[model samples]
Target: MTMKIVKTLFLKAPPEHVWKFLTEADQLALWFHRGAADLKEGGDWTLVTNTYGKEGEKMCWGKVLEMKKPERLVHTFTHNHLKGVETTCTWTLEAVKGGTILTLVHDGWEKYEDDPFGMAANHDSGWDEHFGRLRRVAS
Candidate 1:
């Protein structure tokens, strides 16, 4: 498996605005998923999907490792119900044309792969949907 996966998106807003929706848990719940998130170094972050189960039964639990606003965010991510695996997720923002170009790189997926590109393929599709959702939110 590759060590990293990159997903890029061209949003219709500036880095500052996009970063708000990306970093702030309230704004994030509007587009990404629902959960209470504390925006701080070493803060808690949990992502809940309504399609899955009750409020307390959702997945995507993690902690914020770095919280540099509007430019970079690094976090450790793991599914709430899944054990023995965790990944580092980083979001990088850059100024572009009339908006922001966001690149999300998720590294550390190599350990669970029994076949090459297995994790990459799974993440590729997931990111594609997520980027599309983010674009719609930005627009």
Candidate 2:
């Protein structure tokens, strides 16, 4: 069975502003990781960091599968810890009364069926921690 992680948060910013945080390397570094995103369909994106483990930097990369500006984005994602497994991440932004409601979904854990739940749990917490930082940055 496939597993997925979904997270949603209300950011005290417009969708356009939140889009910048996700697409621009400098803005992304303030909360997520230092990285560059091509921001077009089929384009490439990479996020690199030294904070997760050991001394050297680790990298996560993917291709932009879809882009709808300040509305939605879908990408294929893979990281070192994923053990060559690839997944997909989708971000949806909705304009609300006070700000933007951001929803994130990461799917395709069936590929890691050997330990699906364990891997999902790890990523759940990781996304939570990162979203907390994103909240602060987007606010």
Q: Compared with the true structure, what per-residue lDDT tens digits does model 2 show for residues 1-139? A: 6689999999999999999888887787888788754366788888877475642354888889999999999998888778888889999999998899999999998897568788889989999999999999897
lDDT per residue, candidate 1, 19-86, as tens digits? 88777767787777776664677887787776744765557877889978889999887773225467
Residue 132, model 2: Cα distance from true site in angstroms: 0.6
Candidate 1: global Cα-lDDT?
A: 0.77
Question: What's the number of clashes in each of the models?
Answer: 0, 0
Candidate 2: regions farther than 4 A off:
50-58
Model number with the top lDDT:
2
Clashing pairs in 1: none
- For model 2, where is the 10-residue window of minimal lDDT? 49-58
